[model samples]
Target: MNNTYITSFDYQVPIDKIPIAELRQVFIDDFSDHVDDLESPKFQNITLDEIEAVSVYQNYNPGTEVISVIEKVLTDKSDGRELDLIIDYSVVSKLENGLSIGNKIQEQLNARNALVLSVGNGGCLSFMLALKTAQAFMQANDQYKNVLLFSEDHVIGNRYNPGLNVLGDGASAILLQSETDSTMQLVDVECYNMGRLNPVLGVRHDLKGNFKYKEFENKIQPLHYKVIYDLFNKVLRNNSLKIEDIDLVLYQNMSHNDYVGLKSALQLSEDQLHYGKMKGHGHVFGSDIIINMCHSTEQGKLEKAKNIVAISSGAGFSWAVSLIKN
Candidate 1:
């Protein structure tokens, strides 16, 4: 009841190939196509597969590439349908000057002059929250038909981050339609803000004059699972379903051990918790959940998913779950 409920949806879920939860994502890293391994050796064991940092982009304009990526997704996946609205979830979207990017996108994409809005919410959870916002907009009003929720992020300063997993950049474009059933439909959603763990934007200059990216994931580590347990239980209860009743559960990619710990804590079967994406992409900040959903569907893991649950937690200190029914 607290989340948006769209009555319609339309889209073909690809049983093969990389495509949404259809999704087209691109990562521009200084490390090239190879998984960029970090130089840090102290916490290597704890970080594990997530040690590879997608890093940053200095050559190409990130904003421009993001727009380009969105254009490609629209060209290939939009199916000639015009957009009703665009919700951008990214770190740069918070900039006062960054607002123009939205306008440029709207004008360039032939989106039919759809409204463009920015959601500066960070972390993977921010992406889900943005998706929920789009779903809610269509639910609350019928004027908006299909919505495009785009997420993009880049670390502005250092190439390697000691905080958590992702110290890189990525962009994802997802199409959410109204009044149809071909793609995943938003059944229910829940979001809770724990508090601000990272600054809204900008990097700090330390005594050495090096740009520093700060993260406070350690502060709430103790209460993390408790919050996840309660948040998920509420969403499941709202849908009148239980963990066993759901076919698949996907969480944002983090460390391999993090996934193992979460699966055990949530009492999820191996099939339910699909965290294999972590090995390949590491943590992609806000785009992790969307990419993971696309990964699961293409791998045919999502084929068995009827009442699938996708959840994520972000440095914005927010947790969110979106229950989708096939």
Candidate 2:
């Protein structure tokens, strides 16, 4: 396998920030028809303080959000190497420009030479999916020396995920180099289908072609710790590293309390964890990992981080974990 290094990453969100407090009623209204099930976990004990605010794109064509950040990052692309782009394919912005998700973004970038592709079922695990595929492509295709991996979310209607974190509208662009650099090197990326668990279909279309949300899962399986520990352990074992060998752990901004089981499962110290963009952006799909990574690097925290692991679980009931040596 060819070595892949991440030289830089950038993220963008709409200027508008909607306080979670103000969005409570709208969240409840989204599932009003299903709220009558008093025993359902979706309506249970959801407090406003769990999340502070989530950034959103008012116009709602999330393809623009993905394109904006990539263009901003590529403006300084002086390396002049042929570039290939990989992005989450679920933006649902076809109505905006009548193009496929990947093609719409590629056209917006206007890079005729740049190859573009999409990853399906892109939620919290999309970044890992894209990263793994991008690195593999880099190893096989010599024409491309750098790859841009991006993720953006807005569609699927209501951003709120029931009792989970509010999905924020944002996009992240990560630049990966085929050669080693003084930045982060890809150690390994592992993803599991996890299809047995329930899928988190936020909003769905009805037979009449109208919009409606499926009844939120009466309860989500609480066995994430096992899945996480097993996968992380496998990555660490394959790489000949232990939990104590990792310098930092970045998990998605699912919710404040969601980390309890994760923290316990990983056996990590409080200081070993870095929570970035949680209160500010909430969960921005798999972008949360890249966003948190950029946030940590911007705050000068990466200097203290050597080997880091990012973990996320989402929509397709997928689990993804990546280990990087910085």
lDDT of candidates 1 onward, in order? 0.60, 0.68
Encode model 2's per-residue lDDT on 102-213: one tens digit a residue: 7666666665676777775545676788888887777777766677777666645555555556767777787787753546788788987655444334212121212122
Q: After best superposition, candidate 1 residue 96: deviation in angstroms?
A: 8.5
lDDT of 1: 0.60
Q: Kindly give the stretch of ten consecutive residues in candidate 2 with the minimal lDDT sum.
A: 203-212
TM-score per model over all chains:
0.76, 0.86
lDDT of 1 by residue, 143-178 (tens): 777677776565553333332444445667777766
What does the lDDT come to for candidate 2?
0.68
Candidate 2 TM-score to native: 0.86
Candidate 1, residue 311: how far the Cα is off, in Å: 1.1
Error of 2 at 252 (Å): 0.8
* Candidate 1 Cα RMSD after full superposition onto the native fold (Å): 7.6
